[model samples]
Target: MNNAVTIVRVSLNDANTLLELSRKTFFDAFLSTNNPADMEAYASTAFTLPKFQFELINPNSAFYFALVDNEIAGYIKLNYVDAQTELQDPDALEIERIYVLNDFQGQQIGKQLINLAIQTAVDKNLKYIWLGVWEHNTKAIKFYRSKGFEQFGSHPFMLGSDKQTDILMKKEL
Candidate 1:
């Protein structure tokens, strides 16, 4: 792949594309280590058209698609203020989701997406950026740590009926 990557802000009209990519990337990332029933249940509800539509239109939430050579290779979701899943800090930005296609891993696509998120937060004068990663995802935790994010807390995440722990990490700007 060439070094021709671009991050495009997702719009309402891109709901269908976003939904499909969201489901595909989420499944590729977690399906292997998770229960099939739980994965299916979560995907059915979380990756639907209506859900994407709502998120796409939400004023405090933003989504972006990372395109490599004009093909969607990854995506990121950011939530601000009340739209944040946990701490509703107006001065903070929450990275609710960041996923890169399995085929696109080890290509720095994830890092590029993260840089975009950091730029976005800085542009808004946000105090800090925070995110939740599954505790068992050591790779992701290491990545976040490399970006200067420190573990601050943890919260329970529901993957369908299964409750799991997500380590909260944050980077102070």
Candidate 2:
């Protein structure tokens, strides 16, 4: 397991690195999808630098970068959404995205990124953290559960042509 991971808030100036790392991490994580078309659709947004730049300007969002030996290992995004709408949270925090390179999956970088997101919310005086993970993504659901999240509900996750069911998980801090 890697013990050299560091968490930092991604800055607006790091736009290029953030976009490139996001693409690397996202593609590696989802490249094995059942549909190639879905993968392509995902890649469109995952690789969009301009969109990331726009997101960086959003004050309500928090983006954390995981670095291992000073290199980008993964990233996670957190945003304030309605907890009452998705899960059991009295207050809401949506884990917008969590991406880690496939080669770094077992190194706990994802864990670090997630914890950072949760901590960020807690720091902002938020009461609960929530996220949606595809039902077919067994590993991700398992990881969320291990982190004290529980299945609050399920909904459709829009992939390219098929909308897969996704489990909405939540945890109170």
Candidate 3:
């Protein structure tokens, strides 16, 4: 077990670990929803094992993990998204996902991830860092706000077998 937390690029072999972390983090983040089926589907689909593995090995995408004591405490995904259909700057780098384990909540792990994403985006010469967060995720929304993210637009998202909306947030680096 390491004393200090470490963030590192994930490898294809870490797929199973990533899925497990996603499941735990999603359930923890959305405990108020109380919808097991929806949670399971999300953890297995958007954060599926195969997809996680692909991102780990993908040249165009970078997935980072916060490791504590050699165990994954949280993870973040960064990738490019075409902005042709949106108002956002085409040079913005999309932060696809950020999730922390249940027990790690409220420990500033999320902020750490955000800072990492901003640094990564800047390193790639991206103009901004963007992410889509569930409108219902008030905690996340507030966290983003505290980190200087402003609402840019809305996007459709699936939740509990129903269509929902998510707010797109952006932070200029």
List TM-scores for all candidates, in order. 0.97, 0.87, 0.86
Candidate 2 lDDT, tens digit per residue, 1-173? 45689888899999999888876666566667757788778678656888888778777666888888887778888776432224434367889789887767788888888878777778878878888888888889889999999998889877766778988888888
Q: In candidate 1, residue 107 scores what lDDT?
A: 91
Winner on TM-score (1 vs 2)? 1
RMSD of each: 1.1, 2.8, 3.0
47 in model 3: Cα distance from truth in Å? 3.4
Q: Tens-digit lDDT track for model 1 on 1-173?
A: 55778999999999999998888888888989999999999899888888889989999999999998789999999999999998899999999999999988889989999999899999999999999999999999999998999999999999999999999999999
Candidate 1: residue 91 lDDT (0-100) = 97
* Model 2 stretches with alpha carbons more than 4 Å out: 81-90
Q: Between candidates 1 and 2, which one is better according to lDDT?
A: 1
Q: Considering summed lDDT, which 10 consecutive residues are worst modelled in model 3? A: 81-90
- Per lDDT, the best of the predicted structures is 1
lDDT of each: 0.93, 0.78, 0.78
User: In model 1, how many backbone clashes occur?
Assistant: 0
Ordered from best to worst TM-score, the candidate numbers read: 1, 2, 3
lDDT for model 1: 0.93
At residue 11, give the lDDT of candidate 3: 79
